[model samples]
Target: MSSRFKMSDLGLLCFYLGIEVQQGHDGIKLLQSAYARKILERAGMGSCNPCHTPMEHRLKLSKASTTAPVDATKYRGLVGCLRYLVHTRPNISFAIGYVSRFMEQPIVEHLNAVKRILRYIAGTLDYGCHYKHGG
Candidate 1:
C-alpha cells in the first residue's frame, strides 16, 4: 500500500480507541477495563456493588409499565456508551440493547436496569475477547 498513499508505521498496536491489546506467546487478548470503569464513573456507580449478570434473568421491560420518569438525556448517554462498549464486550450486548429501547422516555425502572449493567461491568472489568493464535 506504500506505493499508493503515504503511510508510516505506528509500531505494534497496544491500544486503539478504548480497547487495550496485549500480545503474548499464546495469542492476542483485547481488553476494555479502562473504558468500562470510565462508564461506571460517569454514571456515578464507580463504587457500586458488583453483580454476577449484566441484567436480571427473565427481566422484562415495557414502555407501558408504570414507573417514575428518569432523566432522558442521562439515560440515553449511558446507553450510548454501553453500545460503544459492546465492541469489546458482547456479553452485555443483549442487556444494553434491552434497556436502550426506552431511551425516548426512560423511567426509573430503565435507569435501574442501566445501573445493574454498570454493576455487572464492575465485576467483569478484566473480561474481554482473546483471539488465540490457533484454537
Candidate 2:
C-alpha cells in the first residue's frame, strides 16, 4: 500500500520476464511468443516445420529405449526453458513434462521430441488464453 513502502507507477504492464500482456475492452491477454521463439533458436530449430500437435498420440517414452544418449545439460536447459514458457502456454505443458522426466539421461529420441514441441510452438505462436472481464 502507498501508506507503507514508497512505490512508483510503472504504468500498464505490457511485458515482464518474457511474458507479453495486453489489455483491452474484453479483458487482459497474456502470451510468451517471444520466449518461445528464443527457445527454438537456442535449440537451433527456429526454422523447423510446424506441427499440428505438441506430441503424437499414443506416444511412449521409456529409459529402456535403445537410443544414443544426448547431452544431459543441454536437454535439461531446454526443458527448463519450456517449463517456464508453460506459464502462458499450457498447451505444451504435457509434452514438456513428459520429456522432462528424462533430464537425468536424455536420449536422441527425447531431443527429437523436444524439437517437435518447438515446431508446434512455431505454428501456434499467437495461441494464448484470453481472460474476459466476466465469464
Candidate 3:
C-alpha cells in the first residue's frame, strides 16, 4: 500500500480516526478519553456522578413488551459512534456491543444505559489497551 501511494510519515500517531494514541516505554496505548469526555459534556453528563459499570448487571435489552420511551435517532447515533470508538478501544466493547443489539428500537432505559456507559468512560478516562512497543 505504501509503495503504491505516497504517504507522509506522521510520526508516532498521537491522534488518528478520532482515537488518541500515547507512546510509552512499554507500549502504545489507545484511548478515546477526550472524545468520551466531549460526548458526556454534550449529553449533559460531564459533571454527573460516576458509576462502576456502564449498565446494570441485569440489563436485558430487546425490542420488548415493556420498555421506557426515548429518542430513537439519538440512541442510534450514540451507539454508532461508540461502535466506532471500539475499534481502537476495546475496553468498552462488550458493553457497547450489548446495547447495540437494541438500536433499532431503543427506549429511555436504553438511552440512560448508554449515558451510563459514557459516564463510566468519564470516570475511567485513563483506561485503554496497550500494545507492546516491540511487537
lDDT of 3 by residue, 51-90 (tens): 8887788877667747667788878888887787677667
Clashes of 1: 0
* Residue 73 error, candidate 2, Å: 0.8
Q: Cα lDDT for residue 61, model 2?
A: 88
Candidate 1 residue pairs in backbone clash: none
Residue-level lDDT of model 1, residues 1-135, one tens digit each, is 989999999888999998999988999989999999999999998999999999898998889877889889999999999999999899999999999899999999999999999999999999999899988
Q: Tell me the tens digit of each residue's lDDT in model 2 across 1-135.
A: 988989999999999888899999999999988888888899998888998999989788888778899999999999999999989888788999999898988899898888888889999998777899987
Q: Which should have the higher lDDT, number 1 or number 3?
A: 1
Candidate 2 colliding pairs? none
If scored against the real structure, what TM-score would every candidate get?
0.92, 0.92, 0.82
Candidate 1, residue 63: lDDT = 95
